[model samples]
Target chain A: MNRQHIWAVLLRNLYLVRRSQYRAFSLFYWATVELFLWGFVTLWLQDISTPDVKITLVATVIGALVFWDLFFRVQQSLTLAFLEDVWSRNMLNVFASPLRPRELVAGYILLSLLFGFISFVFVLVLAFFLYALHIWSLGYYILPFVVNLLFFGWALGFVILGFTIRYGPSVEILAWSLPVLVQPLSAVFYPVSILPPLLQKAAFFIPTMHLFEGMRAVVLEGRFDVGHVVWASLLNVAYFALAIVFFYWMLSLARRRGLLSRLVMD
Target chain B: MQESRLPGSVGIPPILKVTDLAKSYKHLTVVDRISFQVEEGEVVGLLGPNGAGKTTTIHMLLSLVKPSGGSIQIFGQELAKDREGILARMNFAAGYAALPYNLSVYENLNIFSLLYGIPDRRAKIEQLLQEFQLTRFRKQRTGALSSGEQTRVGLAKAFLNDPKLLLLDEPTASLDPSIARDLRALVRNKMRAVQGAILWTSHNMQEIERVCDRIIILKQGRIVAQGTLEQLRRQFEQDDLEEIFVALMALPEPAMEQTERPR
Candidate 1:
């Protein structure tokens, strides 16, 4: 992929982010609101906890909140970035340049990292100052778990982008809802034990299941489940590979079908 | 960026060369067995009615559409193998495709310049901003611009690289007369200065006649006739290129005309 091309994509997208108040507001607002909603609830749960409850009540809620937003931040990073191109009708312009298909992906991947990190900083600071909660309080080793969730978000993002490109805007509703559809299976909030046994079986294929399960272990039981971490990492790589391959396929399909011109929004 | 040139050390090859170019969907052909060439500094007009496969032909040349059967060689390099190299020296604009709505005109041009790896991006952008009279509107969102202003911006973006081959699809549709005249002059002057070849598509017969050195008229996915304005006028016994175009559209080809949707 061309670095200059990648930089061009990034530069334009960031310009959109900087210029549009609505876009910038949407990026920062959701995480802050999610933090507040869960932050107060965690405080309420801490008040009513009994001795057998055993878990650090606030940490579980706060960790789940922070990491869920990380997953969400990257998801929006990838999905919204693709939508920016679609909505602006800018895909044809970019494709006409020397930028390759993979360069588009590379550029958005960089934006995902950039936005994901910024969201992380904002949410982390809010959680710390408001609830006196720290992700560090869980342990520095949770970094891998965070990375796994972010990759999973990126994977889901590619799937959404693929569907949008191949099917056109008629099915772009899939882009917004697909990630949330996986959330129930992901077990982002409650334990995997809370899931029905059949869903438990399906959850094994979902890497975030392993992550939330592993996060509970670290935060509540004071143990790092290397097995879950390893499983999540391997699945992250596998899913990410498949999604990217599928995305490239969809792009060529869009071109061959003469559908790129009509791949616009209403 | 410095242009990535073909191996034209001794003599310049045709700027664009297409051999047996055709496109089809299943059994339905959209563009059929059309061949053409454009030389250095020549502006060729691609004139055709709606559904005549003019857009499809342009898309194939840009590698945006897959032709059912054909070969395209731009600057003596095969398009399939040298797409990046060829596209780097080429740029296109259509009234249909859009710039980012949220980006300012300056940001949009800057992004494209960086993508093309232009050697002096700032100077290039500043020059275009002045030429398009977009300097004052540099900070305005592109979507907020008036239609005529947007057309100007589109043209400005297209000319950013001073490409050797430029493809314009209804490029001046929304421009005022003065702006349109200036843009036509720009295309005219670029060819003299850089030997740039433009494959321009416009419904305005007057505009095409003014700018194009040679004309290729298509009807129902096939090139019905092609020549200089004088040559075509002489052949069709018509007084003007517009009349020649009207006469060509009157030909019988209902089978090719309506069987498939314009791609």
Candidate 2:
């Protein structure tokens, strides 16, 4: 389709999220709870450590929260996306349209990233007043973080999308839980090296580990870890490419088997 | 392909043409060796029982499902290769299918307008809202609308860009009789006015006879009879279309029992 069509599709999705207050309310509640839960930990640590150590600890925590929200919440976002179509049975209309499978996927991931950006901005603004913790050079680092987050989230979101498309709605619970389960494995709450050797090696395979590391290094220490950023970016690209291939292949198979129209039946 | 001498046979290509189309699941053929061509400005009914592969055939036409064996050309272009081109000129609607409910009726229609890349979307949407009698519910959520209203919205969304090929599945499934009649008339008028073709699926034989120029009766994934209502009636030794439909859906064992009774 043309550029105007793509923009209309994109804007329409955003408007839906805005009108329903579903995504916005989700972000608000999630951010508020995280702020209080993490805020307590920051306070507890400050009582035990010197001012410099406390500052470092808080910065890492904030960086970790950003990565956590992006990686772990991605599946939730995808579930929201797929569920809307399934619950309303509107998927048939979309599948009937001329929009390419790739275009629909791109539109969805872009929406997810857009929502992620909103959450990031909302938390940042609320954190300023709630915690008084200043994130140094945030303006410079935000764009890169978002770019990385988009790739990473879409890569993770695709696996869930594939499952939903193939196995149907029963797997949605697993889809939501996957993100939360991957949090610790992704090194969002701690360093990858701190895990068991086997787990640490396994963590290296996840795209988010490198992202959280790069984010923590840059935002917390004012040190941009170029090697980590490059590695993370490459890993995300590879994962996203693999997801695209997987989805298209499944779609072709589904079409050949005439299972695509049976999407609602299953 | 042989070109038939129908009216408006000038430059307009057939809306849909399929050759040796086939689809099977687990070695069981659902749509086997089906071949049909729908000309522009024609409405064809796909009539069959529950598992007779009507939906499967439509899916193949829409490219929602790929053919196991043959070719599908929409507007004279292969669907697999010219998907976007073919799809942009087509639209589909069904009662069981709903638009994105989280979106308002207006936003839902607007999104589809955008998806189809219709120019002057606002004016077009307004015209559709008034035409579909959905003007008052423009800003209301789609989920809140009754099933009949939702189907109307679906229809409005489908025809928003005046698709050249429209695939409708039970277009009047859950609507009241009055609304159903209205929709049927609207579809007929639109098809006549706009050089479009419709592939409609329904069990309503009266509606079929009233609206369809041709009908394809499918049984067990194969075409049992296909022609205009008059042609099918004479060929089947039936006075009406309903008898032919019953004979197609009828079981063989009961006839054996009745014959064996020898009353």
Q: In terms of DockQ, which candidate is strongest?
A: 2
Docking class of 1: medium
Candidate-wise lDDT, in order = 0.83, 0.76
Worst 10 residues of 2 chain A by lDDT: A70-79
Per-prediction DockQ? 0.63, 0.64
lDDT of 2 by residue, A1-266 (tens): 36665565578667766887766688667866887899889889889998777767766786567556755455466557766676667777788887777677767766676677677777777777877767655546655666777777777778777767776677777666777676777787577789999998888877778777776777657777777777778888898899878877777777766655556665
Lowest-lDDT window of 10 residues in candidate 1 chain B? B1-10
lDDT of 2 by residue, B64-152 (tens): 88777889998888999988778888888887777877789999998888888888999999999998999999999998999989998
Question: Which lDDT tens digits does candidate 1 get at residues A48-130?
Answer: 88855624766777778888888888988888888888888887887788888888888888899898889888888888788
RMSD of each: 4.6, 5.1
**TM agreement with the true structure for every prediction:** 0.93, 0.90
